[model samples]
Target: MKPPRSLLVITVTAVCLLASQGAATWLLVEQSRTAALATAGQTVKRTLGTAAANINRGFLQVDALLSGLESLVAPSESADPAGPNRKLRNLSDQNFLVRELMIVGADGQVVASGLEATRRHPPALKSSLLADDALPHGGLLHGGLPHGGLPHGGLIVGDPLRNRLTGEWSLYVGRAGRWKNEPVVVVAEIPLSNIAQLALPETTTAGLRVSLERTNGQLLMSNPHDARNTGQILGPVSDRLTPGGPWAVVEGRVSGRRVIGAATPALHEGLILVAQLTEEEALADWRETRRVVLIASAALAAVVVLLAVGAVLYLRARDRAAASLRWSKRLLDQALDSMSEGLAVYDANWTLVLTNRRYVEIFPHLRDVAVPGTPFERLARHAAAVVLPAGTGAEREAWAEWRRRAHEGSESFEQTFPSGLTVQSTQAEMPDGGIVSVHRDVTAAKRAEEHLRAARDTAERANRMKSEFLSNMSHELRTPLNAIIGFAEVLERNGAVPEAVRIDYARDIRLSGEHLLAIINDVLDMSKLDAGAMILHESVCDLRRLVGAAGNMLREQARAAGVLLRVMIPEEPLPVLGDERLLRQVVLNLVSNAIKFTGRGGTVDVAVVRAEAGGLQVTVIDNGVGIAPEHLPNIFQPFYQVDGTASRQRGGTGLGLPISRAIMKMHDGQLEITSAPGVGTIAVVILPAVRCAASPADEVA
Candidate 1:
């Protein structure tokens, strides 16, 4: 009898599954071995690349140092040989990498040396290192001219050599220049150990060896510096010697042990960096990883079939979480950018972690310097260099240090740049020992504060002046009104008195009333000027006649006060366009003030003449006790009296000069006054040339 059909099918399926799993397992193991070897090659390649970058940077720094020395050796009007020599010595002492500094002449003789011993016994140049027929011609110099040639004010890095005197391996960096019409070179010698320190990593994996070599395969540095292997060739030459070159890797026998090797050209010219690892050492970790991966693959194949549905759900959830995280980061960035104030966040390690757009705008100078992972001190130094006021040496360093310290504190402070920009910086310390800083511009606010202070001071001053004027006006008006009222009362009850006494009282009342009327008129004129309500009825009038009329009106008063009054008028009529009445009032006020201020025997002179620029000028001069210089500026202000007691004694309001000036301004003229304490005062009124014309009308009476 035949077996059941179901049992036959199950038996066939089991056989096929076993055969496929055995093939897959063998294929997976082979592929893992190849991937492991590729990973090892990549590891060595990266290591070599890093070493190359470090060496390139070291050479660049040395080139920069040599370039800086060019300016020191260049011709200067205040050239001091001893000073430059001392500076060179100081620079060499400060940099641990530099072994010596020397100024070499065109003939290759040492002119000046930083070291005292080198100065006394200068070493001769090795002809082989600087041979004319060398590959680079002048040496292995870079950074300036090609073929190792150095241009004027250019730097070059020369071939490495053993110093004849010191017996130390050194690299030469030099700058070429002409000082006092002689070709001069400033050269620095750096020891190989210093270069190694700059280019080599501090620590590396065990059994790994790093070698720095020239393009010619000559080893410049070896980590172990084995006595048997020193100065030997470093394997085969690499074709990748160009800038940004790809790293090359190879499997080779080194020190009689199979190893994986990688090589890359340093960014510096004619230099290559190589990294080597013994094959056993390099593949040890990979072998363990392979064993685990093989075992896990077998188990995973079985479990994958059972848990396929659950794996799909887990992957979907992970994708959703990743998308949400990306969205949150974008939202946070937008929120930070929306802030008006500049914001920067630093991690606990003092490295910049985040910054808003406003921060870049506020410190545009720091755009290149302030980036993620930048140290706080680096940003501070850049800020000080770009924004701080001009300072030298120690002062500049101090400013940078102060800025660094200021940033470290949580206090809010203001920083003002030389460009007149001001920013108020506030810092908050996070719970996790990080820091958040916000910078707000306060330039406009500070300016507004200054303006407000000035306005307040001006208002206070005006208030004080107004109060004094009111007090003086009250005393002046009350005195005149009191006398008029007293005299009027006496006159009204004169029926019981004699006719002569009654007449005397009447005259006294009339005089007091007139005096009061004058004071009222003066006040009214000042009020009109202040309110800008005064109008001018302009017409062509004779200035000479006006001066004569004013002199005549004040002549009697001047004589009464025992003062001499004089009028000097040009024979030709000086025509001016102005209101006749106002012009007459202006002249009258000036003449009156002159007469009132003059003492006995003092002279008051009024003159009218044709001024330069075809204008009309009127002068009122007085040989009186003149105004003090300190009081002259305020003399044109209404009710300003040089001497308040004198204003009362003279029986006149102190508005004459101010009123006159206002009328002159209305006519497009100017009133100027010059006075000395004892040398008397001179007041001149200048009318515009266009307003003056040949007029037939005489000045008003």
Candidate 2:
């Protein structure tokens, strides 16, 4: 019993379509009315304009004839002034259209006239000419021109002339007579019925009539049949007409229907040209156009209704399908809110349409204001929120880089801030003409990674310090122990008393005491370095002397091992500033390392040079059962030796090179090494330039 949803949807859509069609129909009707009114107005203006032009031309022609007559008799050098005036008066009488011509002298005397002599005296012409008004006022004077008892009306053109030699103007006048030679004073007596006749020729309908009126409300001319007294001058023309010479008048009725009128002023005079066409004739063609347009409009409405009904059904089906697909809408919204990352959705114009909780949290100030709608760009600027530290030019460059990548559709990217916050952001285009932005904060993750790396480096540094201390301590203690052992052996070798008992006691004491002392020294030096309490004994030293002393110190040990020992010294006295004790210790360690590694018959050499480039080089070269390629790289690492057990047997602590490296570094120098699998090893010490003031012995003493 319920209507199907499709039917209901169709019904709603049909209602909308009907409304649209009605609007279209109203628009069409309005357009037609506007067109009709415009056409009517244009026609009226065009006909009026043509009539004005014709009237102006006719008025000017009359004026031109009057000017010609005036120039023919200039009064200035007339041998007999009265005689010349008489001759001009005779000239005016010769033309049938000229009503009168008169000569009035400077003294206001009517010297001569074409009319009766008594009637020719001036009344106002003298005062009018001398006044500051425009020149030669000659047009319809309602009282008509003078003379032989008939009305004379049309136009009058007058000019005040000055003789070429004398500078005074004299008035000359000519006129158009109303009926062949008869003259009358009033302008209305001129037969303008000729003009009315010409306005509508033979094709004009039988009942139509045209007439012309003067601005004074007096009729000049009209078709004989249009004698109906219009109670007053009708329509716009008479009320608005301006006063002056040289204008025309037009007025009329058609079929005795509604009156219509238009008027225009003449070019030469202020006269108006008026025209009228009544309603019956103006609307004669309207019925046909209205019939055609109305029929067409009705047919168009029927077609639109049918098409609209079909479209309604189709659109309803589409709407239902779209409504069925709304399952994911809520889920998507919840996901955006749930994210810890800042998420925002923007419309096509980049206005922010939606922002998640994280976005609101990050930019809390935004909550106090209106929520930005539909475009992200309309919100606050991104650059205003982000900042970089000064002097980190590289960080500022990253924003420029991000903009370039964004324009190129590089949708996802990571950026790090000087505040040490790192963010990964992505841009996603939404189906509804918008973009969704997701930003994840990475500050904590980066800081944690940095902390872990620092910890590993700290552990490595501590282990190296331990091994270095052990090596330095062992070397220091063993040197004194060697001296003790040598002395003990010398005593046992004297061959006095019980030699066997002395020898055993000497050997036990020598071995046990030396080992214990070495351990004690290693532990002490390690403690000093760890506590940050190690001090340097700085003094000036001769480099050549130090190298020689270092060589001599290691020579006996080298000889005991059956390795050849050699020393090279620079001829020039090399001066340096450093801790002489550590410097000497460094040399001893290098030489000992050479000796320990050398084979029984192999050679060990120490060379000191005034290095060419403003430094000193001391190299220890040894040919032993040489180091392997892999073992050579880590040989200087603390607790790292090519052969660990063999190094112990040869009396090494495995931290000799590390201790030497630390000592050289304290003195602003470095130890470098090079080795091959079966070739001799080379250890070189390079020291920076230093100014030495006094000798080590002098300073110590």
Candidate 3:
């Protein structure tokens, strides 16, 4: 129920201003409002009169023409229908206001259409004119016609009708008479837009809602040519307009808004010309004048308040400054004597405000210049020169600027002095926009931490290596070894074993021996590559045949894993100057790894194509449970696995990719593997163009 705090304050302030000015200011505002409204009312009166005259003048011409038509138009249809129609057409064409003219018989049939008569749209006379036996010769000249339309001082006006053929609206004005003792009617079709044009003033004025309305407040047409507003029962403000009475400006509400309006004496019976100006529009100048005066009054009051407030603030600030000075001196003395840490303070401009004795002792070279009111850049440059004695002038200056920026920015950082002592410095912001920084020696603690960290890292690395080797080598090497030994024992111990069972045991022994040899060979080959002992024995070999051989070796493995392994190669020989043995090993690794990782029903494609880089390449792509992005970068590192667990179902020492890439590098080739987790992987083996035999342009990237 209470007023807003700001509004209440504003009200009190305005009341005070008004009281100081007395009643003169208030009376001036009221007078301005009255003058603006009176002016608007006068303007409305003039415009209303002008519009009324314009409308009446237009209709007077129509009246004179209709009066002449009454005798000219007779029952000529009985003799020559086309002859009468042609005469009426020529007459209607002379006037821009009229649409068309027609003569109808007593039966309401189109006796003659001046334009055209068709079965679809006959210009039949509305029964309102035919049925009515009016008192006057040309019917009620200005009374509303029984059909529809604003009353006009002319022949009887009928409803505004649309020509069905042309889709044009017109006001039907008819003159009824008996020609040769038979009833006949003369009708004039008038365009509604023409009537609206006549009602409008030649020059328009803003903020005026000008329209022609019936005496009963029913709108006939608006000067703005609003067809939708025609026939709308106007507001009560329009009811105040008397068609044949004296014109007066009145204050009233129209269509939910207050307006100043005036009307003219009857332009025609049941018709009045009205013009309205909204209250907001009428009082616009008054409102502007009131705003200026109020603003001036408020400004004067504000000047007084501001002066008083300024004095109070000034006295308080002086006392606070005196107290702050005393407090600062006491703190400085205590910090210099008691504090062990080096401390410095700077103002907002990065000028040295104060420093404790400990700070000067820490950087004795800067002792002379580290004083109050010294720009921090000088002290910082001196400190940087002491810290970086071997640095160039440009480098030292850059260090000084950076340190100055850090001090002003209130940054916490670490630095080492020329004495080789590491200092940890921290900054705090003062309430007056200054900075306070404290520095403590941390050299001894940092040294001890470094030693502990080095020892811990060594111990951890030893433990990790021991665990990986023991877990992976023991499991990988032993599995096939144990199988070979066990299978051999089964055949050796059972001499009475069936031939089929003996053959199976021998086959299992041979398979186990091959798998074990592969694991051992990979380990030895990687060791040779790491020691820089492995070399490519370059020879011209068919790369296509080599890829097919690798595919054949893994075809059964792929089938067992429920993955399709497809090999595509050119029929023509693809000769490459590479170590065929190492190259085969590389392809075997890539294809086997593909099968190992790919899920059931997935596919692995191996294709040989010419490299765009001018050699031949073997592309192996697999839709697999792929290596994650984080692991792809390091996948060619020896013994690296995305999941390094020993119990993982997939078997590998993770040396295959590393050894394969090493062999490719020796041959001046590239082995790239790109993959995304849960999608697929693509491995591209590119042999450099120069290494490709017979042709330099036999490769793809």
- Predicted model with the maximum TM-score: 1
lDDT for predicted candidate 2 compared with the true structure: 0.57
Writing each residue's lDDT as its tens digit, candidate 3 over 646-673 gives 2257877878999998988888889999
Candidate 2: C-alpha RMSD after superposition: 25.9
Clashes of 1: 0
lDDT (Cα, tens digit) per residue for candidate 1, span 1-701: 24335434544554456557657777877787677667776776677777777777766666677674745645356877566667778878877788888776656667777777777766554342333443343632222234334464334545556677777777676666544455566788887777677655675565667777767766767665533444555454563233244433444434566666767666656666777767777678768876887787668656544454355455557667766887899899999999999999999988999899999998899999889999998888778777745767677688788877777898999988887889999999899999999999889999999999999998897887777778777877888789888877776766587888878877877877877887898899889889988888777777777778778877888889999998999787777778988889888888888888888999988888778887878899998878887889998887776664665577555788889889988888999999887678899999988778755645422
Alpha-carbon lDDT, every model: 0.73, 0.57, 0.73
lDDT of 1 at 134: 39
- Total backbone collisions for each predicted model: 0, 20, 11
TM-score of 2: 0.34
Query: Could you tell me every candidate's TM-score relative to the true structure?
Result: 0.50, 0.34, 0.39
**Which ten contiguous residues of candidate 1 have the minimum total lDDT?**
139-148
Candidate 1: deviation at residue 545, Å? 1.3
- Which ranking of candidates, highest TM-score first? 1, 3, 2
Candidate 3 Cα misplacement greater than 4 A, ranges? 1-466, 644-647, 695-701
> Which lDDT tens digits does candidate 2 get at residues 95-168?
43333455443333444454453234343343322222322343322333344443233343232233222332
Looking at model 2, residue 682 earns an lDDT score of 89
